[model samples]
Target: MSILNSWWRALVALIFPPHCPVCDLPLGDEKGPICSPCLASAPLTSDWALRNDTPCDRLSVKGCEVRVVAMLKFHKAPQWRHLIHQFKYHSRWRLAREVGRLYGGKMAGSLFLSDVDWVIPMPLHPLRRMWRGYNQSEELARGIAEQTGLKVETKSVVRVHYTRSQVWRTREERFKNVQDAFRVAHPERLAGCHLLLVDDVLTTGSTMRTCIQAIVDAVPDCRISVAVLADAGGGS
Candidate 1:
């Protein structure tokens, strides 16, 4: 059965070659959803190696004492912007997973994430998840878990409210938009566990702030570290 499946996949690839999500270039025999050139040109964050006082330090001021790190700097980089758009909005699940793997591989040896006991992807509202078919954050989290060997706890935290898009919202508006938006579904399950919160992007840190607050409120002893794929400029 495995051999047949491999053969089928190879025949399918020959008929419809995979292309890089960022540049739309043919992937040919490449393994990832991104072509080699696009992957080489990815806008990586310089702070990936930092253990403390990372570029995402400003996130700590938003009511949560969580440490933060992101894989890419999402400004003035057309390739990254395009890749994020495709992964988040175009149902590019493969792209999301591949990007997450790339980021996880880079950060696997980081001392900051070494003590993380569990990984939790920021949840999407039920309606939105149904519409999108899958949560990109969860896909990313799976990739991270694959490299870090951390357990992924997807059910503990959830988005209770369906807020409007934060794309054009002001800083204050963004903060207000996600207010009371998240809830801890099983506080007991998360008590005293060190968590790594995974997200696709960090814009104003509003959504992550609210989510972290919910987790802390439920499990006061639980410590959190955030990991995002990109940092879209705004709100420090």
Candidate 2:
């Protein structure tokens, strides 16, 4: 049975060679959707696991007591930006998941993240999700769960409104865009739980702040942490 499986895999690979989503290079037996070179050249943020306050400071200013961590520096890295584009626009869910797994493995032993009980991906509006086919954030959370053995809760929180894109919006505009955009679908499940909110990227952080506020409002006793694949504004 093992030999047959191997043979089938080999034949499948021959028929469709896996390619790196970022660089579009042939990925021969490489374990991820991104090439090694792209991964190595990606701009990683300062080690938040060691210092820990750099990323959280910005959230703290916003009245979020949550622990925040981002794995990559989003701006000024063409490779990383292209990778994000692939994951977000091209339906490369595997790429997002692989990146999440790598980051989650690093955070697995971190003092701040090791005790997280639930990994919750920032929810997308149902209509938007239907258009996009799948939520990139949820794929990322699943990857994090794969590494950390944390349970992933997808239906507990939902994006209630269809907001405009934040790409060209100012900081204040961004805040307004996502205000009251999220709601807790299952407050009981999240009550008193330690949650790690996962997102694809952090730009102005307005969206995350709104989501966090909704979660806190629904489950007052829930302690929340945050993790993103990239930080576009570099945080505080």
lDDT of each: 0.82, 0.81
TM-score of each: 0.88, 0.85
lDDT by residue for model 1 (1-236), tens: 99999999889878988777778788777876778887787778755587854335555543347677778866746677788789888888877887778888888878878788889999999999999999999999999888877889999899999998988899899989999999998999988888999998887788888888888878888888888887675544
| True-vs-predicted CA distance for residue 185, candidate 1, Å | 1.3
Q: Candidate 1 — what's its lDDT?
A: 0.82
Report each candidate's C-alpha RMSD, comma-separated, in the order given: 2.7, 3.5
Clashing pairs in 2: none
Error of 1 at 97 (Å): 1.4
Compute the lDDT of residue 93 as modeled in candidate 2. 76
Which candidate wins on TM-score?
A: 1
Candidate 2: tens digits of C-alpha lDDT, residues 1-236 = 99999999789889989777667789987876777897787677646567364436545434348777778866656566777788899887777888888887877777777668889999999999999998899988998889878899998999999998999999899989898999899999988888889998877788888888888888888888888888777646
